[model samples]
Target: MRPATDLAAGRPAAPAPGPDLPLDGLLRRAAAVAPDRVAIRTPLGDTSYADLDAEVDTAAGALTAAVGRTGAVVGVVASLDVPFVVAYYGAVRAGHPVAVVNPLMGDDALVHALGTAEVAAVVAPPRVAERLELLRPRLPKLGGVITAERLPTGLLPPGERGPAADLDAVACIQFTSGTTGAPKAVRLTHRNLVANAAQIAAVHGLDGDSVTVNHLPLYHPMHLNSAVYAAATQVLCPDSAPTAAVTAANRHRATHLYSLPVRLAALAADPGLGELRLDTVRAVLSGGSALLPAQARALSDQFGVPVVQGYGLAETSPLTHCERPADPRPGSVGRPVPGTDCRVVDVAGRFALPTGERGEIQVRGPQLMAGYLHEDGPATDPDGWFSTGDIGYQEADGHLFLVDRLKDVFKHENWLVSPTEIEQVLIRHPAVLDCAVADHPDPSAGAVAHAFVVLAPDAGPLDGPNGPAAFVNGRLPYYQHIRHLDVVDRIPRSPNGKILRRTLREAAAAAPTDRPPGDPT
Candidate 1:
């Protein structure tokens, strides 16, 4: 690993979205509409629309000179920095496909992504070239690698980036959901993003005036596809400031606050939350993981903001169903948004069953991904619908409630352990940040439940950090209790703040028992 100082020197920052709006029109317009207005706030500093957009032009100019051609594949190897924004849009506007790979990934995942996508050139953080050295023997297809820290020396001879890019044009390639092994590279076109944005907008009545507190990372579909992109386009009524989380609604006075189940639980539990002028926030939505019904009810009751649970996979372009404000159901994932179709099918997989039946949940919609990049797949049957792999039931009212993963639900002895059930109980404990339930082989019982917990940062562990066992045994019935524990220093999270379950599962499997989580204070 390299320090920030070792990376390439900084180039001029990129621009925010603006006029003649095409691929990156939002920042341009925001520049015209609110030049002095803060466009994005990070831990670093706030960026005004005008300043940000100008840097975007610089990045485009620099990237255009270096690449020498259109329709090329460009890989970016940087963290969530301001330059990532510039390079992302500059490449798209300049007519190149952008493939973003997590710097944190292992060798196999990286080599597969680059080779599978046929990436010709790479624009990465400094020292990224060194990282690519390992790829030489494996990835024969890869060509030149450019460091974002080093700006191209000169300007290009002037060429058009073509007509304004459409919602249907290729925007970016994001990897999600294959954490157990090879993660899938989801192809999100401009159209799918735009369509989903429109759905969110129409559903929520978003406009130019709205603001959303963006606590999530730029990688998740909720943050990247929905919150940031939608907000920039004024499609889903967007506003995002990174600093707003600590300030509460007291600072930005944001209209929407997007959070995961864990964050929402913490925020709602905060006594100071109600003191802020959050009157403008119409509703709060949670996704990436399931929220316990009790957690859902607690947030709604405390904030006076309806807590709606949303469900979808990275394969589905991130969101297919969200609870609308008008007809709110506390635990229901609400109904499908416009342009989406849903149904519950039986185990054999053919006939659509009645509403009350619990089976595999399937969805079909325009917002679905272009498909995973590496593996040969469209991931659906002859028809357009895709199976969610999750087992759930659709209520007579059309609301969807998740049961357990068809594969995740297991029997220990004769009694079945529903991970979702035990997780709900474990999460309610004040010390637990997030938990994952998996089954390990048990010679006596056939299979036993293994709970891997991530504790809150502020709470010192019963052993050290991530120590979940000491407090777990007395909390739940033995049949469903966690038999093993691993206290990691920190849980691995996605750019969007999602728990990387595949990583946790691998770590757990490698060392089923370590220092016992000693005890919980």
Candidate 2:
């Protein structure tokens, strides 16, 4: 095979992967590398590469028949089993845009997306089918609703025989948070996802020997591009992907696990680790939510695997900065992966700044999402550097340290504040359990710091308002300290456990504060 540089330099003898290189090609390459190896292991059973290939062919035939046209949107709302992968590849095989919808989303959000994106055919499991049925009256353009359990006994469309793909053809559509307003669909082309996969794979040394142990929900970016697409050997998709994760590792002899911090905390706290015979997976990757730096160090020593952090967002095809296993910076997302150029910039999107300066993060690479579905948004700049809306800075050594989400930062007595920094310090408190810090609007200052915390069971009767407020007030600078607080059973979280600060923000906007009329507090 010619070197990638050969293609980059436009040499006459160099071979371009070409616009025709499709998602199926990735599966085909995997087949070449390990034709008969075990590829997907679920609670039901294990599927080898040869079996997976056959399933792809059969499912493709079924998917082609179901869609039967060029301008069709295929939806997959099944559980995270091999069939979902089979159906996804099958849609790509049928040459149609596939939208991977969340099985957990409510009927209203689901209906809004379907209406806005104009889905033609939807394929879903029984549970998802129930929700889709609720919206059936509202969706006028919906051509067909098919269940994952059953395939139609009919012929595929003749037009389903896909010709060469245009690199810009929309392949997948993922949605952003609708909290600010209505959710927007992110358009990703075949080349967009494929190129991002190549960059992620190249940077991590992902190859035929890499066994990815996945438990993350399949809809997330880290789960898709970082774990599934970048994996070289196989992805073990458990029935209860999270609860079954440790078991799958032992069963499949997995070499890597890309998990969120909640999972990592559970694994670290597992009583089975010291007594039970466990699999010898080589690396444990933690991201999507904050992974406590202390947890990284402790898990490394206990489990005998280094836990590394990675960073990215959905718009950038998920991965841009990844930690290298050979030499790691545990708290930092190691560096920009090959083929990706990342930098920190001011809100105006000017020139790149020096390392260690907090600013909005931007990335330019082959893997960026094509654009927001048809609305033409400002997600990416003319230079191809997409604004991640995340705040962080690159270290002098090239490692990236994530500060916080841009939206998560708020004004605290005229100084810009990041909740992550305060939360980091707050978590270190003995009585404090899960902590979330946000800005509560104040009369004198635009907003003041507010905290909600969970206390450890052992800590007696001190989890309420004054308990955490007093602790933070003494430890932090005057402006940085939280002035008001509430005790909650737990922090509101996403299905994945990323802190739901927006929910807290919304509640703050509704509540009345007790502070004096002109006080910043």
Candidate 3:
């Protein structure tokens, strides 16, 4: 058996000091240290570190041979499966910068992502492969489409090239959905990904002995890279059912459970939750969106485990801060992880603000992305601070609180309004199942709050405007009040549970505004 150092092909002969290794380099070190230990556990089967490493080598070699060289951009249709993880690292090891495409994206959005990243090839599931096959003629630069289940099988020759990664090399391009325009690709370097993975491991207390149960609809690189970097075992839970999480955790004695806010909220509201016991679970981590304070509390009290939340964007390797298990906060996203600096800036994106002052949150860290793909947008300043378009504030103790998105905040007369704040207040109503708040343009006031709400099951219809509208109006200030209420069957949300405020705002602009029932102005 060769030492891990011997595997280094294009880089220095000796391993670099600290956790500066490229993304795939972390896998090599894990395989070398714990060859026979299990690295991934899926419903289909379990894969050991040694076998996983060998398979990655085979996949990388095959991809390189098919593409004819390194640095070929590949689009990976991310799914909640082991193959997604394998292909992601394999492509990186083969020196291809992968574009993590959301399989559920609409046709137009998918085309935009594939074209922007200039992907030479696409790897997708059987169903998605068929869709890509139909659109192959549209993508002129697309070399081919490979099914995730059928990743070419062949080992590289003894003299074939191996992972030749540099710190500045682009590892992956993450497409972030913008509120105003099409989704933009976030270009992250090997250094950014590797550093963020290490930071996640440190803050999450992930180690070789830790086992994580992932209950997400798609395979997120943040979870994959961080778990691999820590040499921790990952159990993939494909089902969204809340009870499925308990079964998987207890079956594997999992230490951590990772999921999105939507699923966590459902889990907290599950009627049969009290029947299940999660003795091995230590923490429930939520990301992608803010977890409702009530939902977090309900789950924590029911399961005897801390239900925590974290904050970050695609440009920051997807994880900058996470709540510590020992000191969990219900509403706050906790402080920044090691090596990350966070501060609030004024709305103009300049002049640092005082503590508790709401403004745009900017982060500077080794984990920040190199830049955005295709678009000539300024992702970071000369000082390396990336303005997260999100409106938030940091406490004197450093805990971060997210308010709203910069584009979503609107001016209502003399006051700036956050739709998120009104949405949170409305969801507290027992009859409201889900709701979204958007700015409704007005002639008198610059804008007024409009709410699109989904009522709870079997809930009776309320009087025209006096029901939820009056209920919410009575609780909020004049400028913050929801002037118009639209009853809808459902609220539009992105796949990851973020409210599509832009969609609602557009609808509000086109629809006629109804006068309040009581007509009190």
Candidate 4:
């Protein structure tokens, strides 16, 4: 590994163990431990732990007064800015559940989130605030929009609040990415967020001294809560450019680098990559989607730092398994963190499978959410195990390798076909830049694999006999072959970087066939 140095770094003090506290308590504890230390470093400025705590208190008073009561749901536009962070914890501190909304959502989707969440007030950016006004007629529960600058403050005296909040109360309502359908709100309690934050900190080996650079498009609660729980400093790199992110980490002597899989792949493919260095970065972490194993190895080899990935959903406080830095695995998402149990269940969803047997993955843990918002009850079974709806298998050594989503898998002539497995193989082709496979309806075969491919810019078109469909067919088994192919410029992806397979499925099903008779389809 390349040598690292810390210019203005000091060890962060560890948090003391106690009863399960609310998510906002993370900021308070960090303040108590290191009041003068820098808690957040943004491109514009830095905020000390003490100042951040005070701001939260101030913002809490403003938010509570604006909402007019406790327990009101506040919709927060989750921008990767300092204001959003203050409002997120502030609303929670005032005894209200915060629903984090994607700022990039369309007007219709944003209206849906606000109306479904039943938010009394919204803390949003200037642009999103205007959009909320346009959507206000559709959202009956929405009382008003509160800008970051206009929140009421100084109503509550400093250091005069009551005891730690009840752990069972819902702290935040996280919505799932609606790549396939409408988003569902996951009700997360103080206990759920706190437990997962601790679990993440422990597994990632975070200490007060650790400095993480966040380059994701939006602020994720997993990164926010974990950093606060460990009293670690976080540097926000707002730039989407891969080299810019690396430069920010190097500038701050950041110990951890968090990013999305799409950005990492671009970083690995950058021609100017050889000029940059990550001397202070300990590890590069990817999530939201699977990072290509080849890209992971390339980045690790070039930077002399491990490139690791993790697995989870909004329903599980977003973390269950993570690759270990010490003995990193290239393709696996690594073992489950402390206090989490993972098992593979057969297609029937009743029988547990042996190691290496592919099945639906299920998990039970303290980090599990309380329930879905406005739903009857939690999705978990009576024993607290929640089926993840993901098809994968566990290894003897405990690593998890995800094959594909249960809904995305299909059967061809009594043989199960994994779209992800085929996509992985297709991506290895010399001309293929990215690809997605979906089942196309057929008269005899029931369904056949169809591919949507994005070729490399310089790579010549493979329109002849040696195209992707033929190339992939030669490599994969008969059941896993790509029956049809369409070249596209780009693959549609959600804001968080997950491929929109549902979109591809519709396109593939609509395309007319041009092949000879008795082909795969």
Q: What CA root-mean-square deviation does each model show from the true structure?
A: 10.6, 5.8, 7.6, 7.0
Q: Write the per-residue lDDT of candidate 3 for residues 1-521, one digit (tens) a residue.
A: 11111111112212211387888889989999988889999989999888787778888877777777678898899998878877888899889999999998888888889998999988899999999988888889998898988886445566565656888989999988655568888999989898888888888999999999999999999999998898999999998887898899999999999998999888888988788788899999999998999899988988898998999989899888779999987689997887787877778637677777788888888888888876575778876778888898877667889999999999998898999999888888767899999998888899998888888886654544546667788788989887777889888888999888889999989877567522322
Per-residue C-alpha lDDT of model 2 across residues 436-487, encoded as one tens digit per residue: 8888888777887777778777765453544556666667777777766667
Stretches of candidate 4 off by over 4 Å are 1-19, 152-156, 159-164, 513-521
Model 2 spans with C-alpha error above 4 angstroms: 1-20, 152-161, 177-181, 219-231, 235-244, 271-273, 276-278, 461-466, 516-521
Number of clashing residue pairs in every model? 21, 1, 0, 1
- How does residue 193 of candidate 2 score in lDDT? 77
lDDT of 1 by residue, 107-210 (tens): 77788888777777777777667888757678887777777766442333455343467666666777664544566677777666656655665555455566
After TM-score superposition, what is the CA distance of residue 518 in candidate 1 from its true location, in Å? 19
Worst 10 residues of 4 by lDDT: 4-13
10 residues in a row with least lDDT, candidate 3: 1-10
Alpha-carbon local distance difference test for all models: 0.63, 0.69, 0.84, 0.84
